[model samples]
Target: MKVLLTYTSMTGRNEKIANYLADYLKEKGADVDLEEIIDTDAFGLTDYDAVIVESYTYHDGEVPDEAQDFYEDLADVDLERTKFAVLGSSSKKHIHFGRAVDYFTMQLNSSNGEQVSDSVKIDQDPDEDDFKRVRDLGDRVLKSLK
Candidate 1:
């Protein structure tokens, strides 16, 4: 399956999670296109069998500035047949932990993408359990494509 994995990582944790998940999906035989969210085209998601988004929440629970264009663009895209999932690594210290993950998940659903897994939100750093959840998210997305 062709999967598009787009992410934004200011502190590297989300980038690491995105890479790990991309590798996990690749090992399972998926054709994965890993890109930075700013470099990705929201209108192009429909070209993939599955799409995954990873991000970091910013001040007051906003999508990072670098990814704002893509986030807003998502509202206009139609993903009726795209299977999707969202995950983020943010500080649990923040009251709105991983809110960007929530925003993306809701927007993708609103765009009509078939959600393949529940969104994942990891605090500051990922531990063993967090990695497992990321893998599980990847597994669900890949499975839904079959």
Candidate 2:
């Protein structure tokens, strides 16, 4: 399967998570493309069989400024043939923890992408269990291709 994994990170937490997921997916034999969210084109999603998005929620529950364009552009794209999953690392200290993950999940669904896994919201950094969930999420995305 051809998979695109796009992400944005400020404190490097999300970046670490993105890489871990990418490695996990690659080990499973998926042709994975990893890119920053700013470098990804929402319209280009049609080229991939699946997409996995990871992001850090900005202060007060906002998508990072750099990812705003790609987030908005999803509204214009149709991804009925693509499977998707979203996950993010954000401080649970914030009232709206990991809101960016929620936003991406909803937006992808709205754009007609099949959600292969439930969105994961991690607190601050990932713990062992968090990493396991991330792996399970990747596994689900890959399994969807069958």
Measured on C-alpha atoms, candidate 1 has an lDDT of 0.94
How many angstroms is residue 124 displaced in model 2 relative to the true structure, after the best TM-score fit? Answer: 1.1
TM-score of each predicted structure versus truth = 0.98, 0.98
lDDT per residue (tens digit) for residues 1-146 in model 1: 99999999998998999999999999999999999999999999999999999999999999999999999999999997689999999998999999999999999999998998999999888999999999999999989988
lDDT of 2: 0.94
How accurate locally is residue 16 in candidate 1, as Cα lDDT from 0 to 100? 93
lDDT against the true structure, per candidate, is 0.94, 0.94
lDDT of 1 at 44: 94
Off by over 4 Å in 2: none
Error of 1 at 140 (Å): 0.3
Model 1 ranges with Cα > 4 A deviation: none
Could you tell me which 10 consecutive residues in candidate 1 have the lowest summed lDDT?
Answer: 78-87
